[model samples]
Target: MDYDVVIVGASIGGCTAAILYGRAGLRVALLEKHRNIGTAKRLCGHFLLGRAQAPLQRLGLWDDMVATGAGTGDLSIRTEYGWTDRSRVDAPPFLNVRRTTLDPILRGRAAASGVDLLLGRTVTGQLTEGRRVTGVRARLLDGTEETHTGRLVVGADGYRSKVASLAGVPERFTPNGRAFFYTYYRNVRHTLPTPAVVWWNDRDWVVLGPTDGGLTEVAVMPAKDTLPPDLTDHAAYIERYVASLPDAPDLTRAERAAKVVIAPDYPLIRRHPVPAPGLALIGDAALTADPTPAPGCTWALLSGQWLADATAPALLAGDDPAAALRRYRRAHRAIEREHAFMRGDAEAGPPSAVQRLLREAAVHDPEVSRRLALVGMQVAPTTSLLNPALAARALLVRHRSRRRSAGRAGHAPAV
Candidate 1:
């Protein structure tokens, strides 16, 4: 084997994996197709939720990330009901950084850890011994072919992962159910302080993410079918949509800091038969979700850490990596599957009965609001809201709030 581990795609997941593997004294090769090496993904705003706190702290990535003028603050969500009280929710702040700026930091850290950084190499095929994926064949920028073998091959490539295909990892996909659009707007001075806000409108969800370079990202995810006929005029429609949002930003005055990117919908895929013999998958290769909740970058980094945490020692100890790989797979499924189900329930239609109860309760009860914020910020699992005690509390709060409103209505002054 040319290396202990060969990682394809040098995004957050692949780079972090390479860093950890190399830090563990393992021979690692990190390959990316982008020759520039600082290229960033364009789909989402690339914010890291509270779930990222532990992983970033463990990997020691947050400080350097923050030092690079990355924005960090508690996320504020405003449903039709009302805004989540930012003061009451004390969870860790979300990390907001532009990928164009953040990618190099990861690359630097990965390089510093002694990982072989292979740029501009597109994986065309994978090598196999019997049924195990043992390596990858690649084509260079100059059209030169290169073959590299490793004890394990990791597919950290994005949503359209060629590595997964070559390793025969079949993908099970579902529609995101909403069309997405986002762009950075300059001079977006919100009332709040560097706040990350998501406003859920009647049929659309809008998020105003304030990130580096003093720019605010306004992203909208609306029902896929509700799109206007002339979707070509994205700027016009997007501006119209922004104006309709609650306390909307003045997009007409704000200059677009970036290009307007639109997607019909992203496919949701949580890998089914991954962790194949001598192969593993991380980041979007293993699972992908719509940008509605913006879980991509966080999951990518966490999955990389989890994979490295699980397999490094075993690889060094010369033990079968299956056990460690199994551990990683279970962890990934437990969290990602739960989150996916929650997202599915949400996007299937309007809020479900339980969702209604939670949202209503989040507005009334401080504790529920905090927990809900935690869940929304990805600090707590979505299932945490499913606790019987918590559900009862939410119901009780909603019930009391309704009663109080009814009483107030009955005693209201005549107009």
Candidate 2:
């Protein structure tokens, strides 16, 4: 094999995987289609939540990321009812950095850690041996084709991954029902409880946050079929809708930093069994859920770390890659199951009678609000969100509230 591991794509997930393997002294080939290092994908929001902090700290890049002058602020979520308003919450919150700035930093760090950076290279196909992937075939910048073999090949190529299709890994599709248009702006006093701002306008949503270089990143997600025709005049569109919404003026007429970028076609899918005989997929390639749950850079980093842990022993032993691949698949599925639970709950909504009662209680009760936050954040298991004890408490609260209302109406409580 030319390399111990060949990673397709050189963005956050691919580069992070390379960094971990390279640190393990594995010969790694990191391939990127784009010529430039740190080339940013326009559509991403670049929000890194608190959970992903531990992995960066482990990789020794946490301080470096902070030094990069990424946007620092409070993280808050707004529903039609109101913002979760957690700026007062005591915790080291999320960071919003531009992909262009942060990706290059991560890629550079990976190369410095001894991963071969194959920039300006397009991977065209894989070398398979009857159900086992052996390596990849790629085209170089000068149009030269090369075949690189590796014990393990990682398809961190993202949502539209050719590797997943070519390797015969089937992905489970989830209709996003929506798409997004985003751009950067300046001179917006968009302060929040944390660096990230997530606004849920019923089913539609919008987010605005600071990225690298003090530019505020703005994105509006609407149902795919309902997008406005003229994105060139995005500000005018935003102004008409956001002006009346509470705390949304920051998004209406902010100074423009760049032209609007529209992603009216990114569908969400969750790929199952993220590994094969010699290949493993990570990041968006592994499992993609709705952005409403805020799975972005943080999830990518976390998944990359998972790939590293799963394959480290195999790389060390220089043995058949199947062992590593199996472990990788199992670990990836475990993480996916965790996210799957959240995704399922999101799709179902609070539909059951118990859930409806709890939601109504949460609207007025502080304790219920905390529990709601836990479920929304995926901090608690899906089952925990519907715990019998919690449900009983909610039912009790609902009963009390109804009795009080009836008393105010000068009528006996209805049976």
Candidate 3:
């Protein structure tokens, strides 16, 4: 084999995997279709929550990320009823950094780790032998075609991964029923207790968070049917939408620092069979939940680490890499299945009755609020909020509040 692993993308997941494989003394080929590996992804929210910290630390990038103006803060969510603030005492603070700053750092680290980084190369097709994927046929920027053979191939190219398509990975997609648009604003004041604030009003949702270089990322997700036809005037549309939101920051006071970014027409949830024979998939190639929750970067980093950990020993020892890949597939499914289910449900429509009850209960109950936030941040399982103890507490709180309201009505003067 010309290389041990041929990774299809140069983004966070692929770079992390490449770095790990290179550090283990395995030859790695990292390919990127883009000329500049550090180019910022337009549609990303770029908010890395608590769960991403451990992986960043393991990659020796925690302090560097912090130094790049990333700050730790809590999460605040506001619904039509009211607001709920959640701050976890035990978890690390969330890190908000733009992909422009974050991606380059990862790519640099991957190159320094001795991986062969190939830029401006498009993988046209895969090289397969019988039932197994062996490598890829790539076309260079100059229109030159080359076949690079490797022991294993990894598809980390993202939601519309060519590798996954060519390798015949089974995929399932669920529509989110919304479209997202975001842009950066400079000199915007941060008013929330948490660095991140999410507001849900009717069929509309907005998220605001601080990112590197003193810019605030403002993202809006509205029902697809509500989108205006003239999206070419992005600034006008975003400003008008923000102005309509109750208690939203005045965009007139802040300078628009970047072009408005829009998500391409694609489903919010995509699930694929993760591994087959000598082929493995990670990051968006394997599964993608709703981006409305801002879980993409965190999941990418985590999935990459998980795959590398599973396959490193096998590659180093000349053992069957297929066995390790299978283990990775199982572990990935086990960890992400429930999360994917919850995200799919969320994308389909408004909160369910139970979800609404929990959110309402969270307003008056700190523990409930914390658990909800943890689950949203992917630090805890969705079952945490569904536990008997928590459910009982929520019901009791509702019962008490109802009784108090009834008593007040009984003693009150006629309106």
lDDT of candidate 2 over 1-415, digit per residue (tens): 3999999988878988899999998999999999898687766767676666678788888888778887765556665545553423443456677777788888899889999999888999899888788899999889899988988888888888888988878777765666666778888875455456666665567777777787877777665555566556765665555565577754545678887776656556777544567788888887776664566566678788888888888788977856666776776665576676645534433345555565566544556656665544444445676688887777777677778889999888875
Per-residue alpha-carbon lDDT of candidate 3 for residues 1-415, written as tens digits (9 for 90 to 100): 3888899999988998998899889999999888886775666778887888899898889899989997457768776656763543344568888888988898999999999998888999999889888899999888988887788889989988899889777787777777778898998864666677878766677888888898888888887777877567767787888888766788879999999888745575455545568888888888776776777788888888989999989988877797888778777875576656645564546677777777777766778778877877778877777798998898776666556667888863322
- How would you encode candidate 1's per-residue C-alpha lDDT over 276-335 as one tens digit per residue? 788989988888866777778888888898899999999998787888988888778755
The TM-scores of all predictions, comma-separated, are: 0.94, 0.86, 0.92
Alpha-carbon runs more than 4 Å astray in model 3 = 85-90, 228-234, 244-246, 269-273, 346-348, 402-415
Q: After superposition, how far is residue 19 of candidate 3 from its true place, in Å?
A: 1.4
Candidate 1, superposed: residue stretches over 4 Å from native: 346-348, 411-415
Model 1: C-alpha RMSD to truth?
2.6
lDDT of 3: 0.80
Per-candidate RMSD vs. true structure?
Answer: 2.6, 3.4, 2.8
lDDT of 2 at 97: 76
- How does model 2 fare in lDDT? 0.72
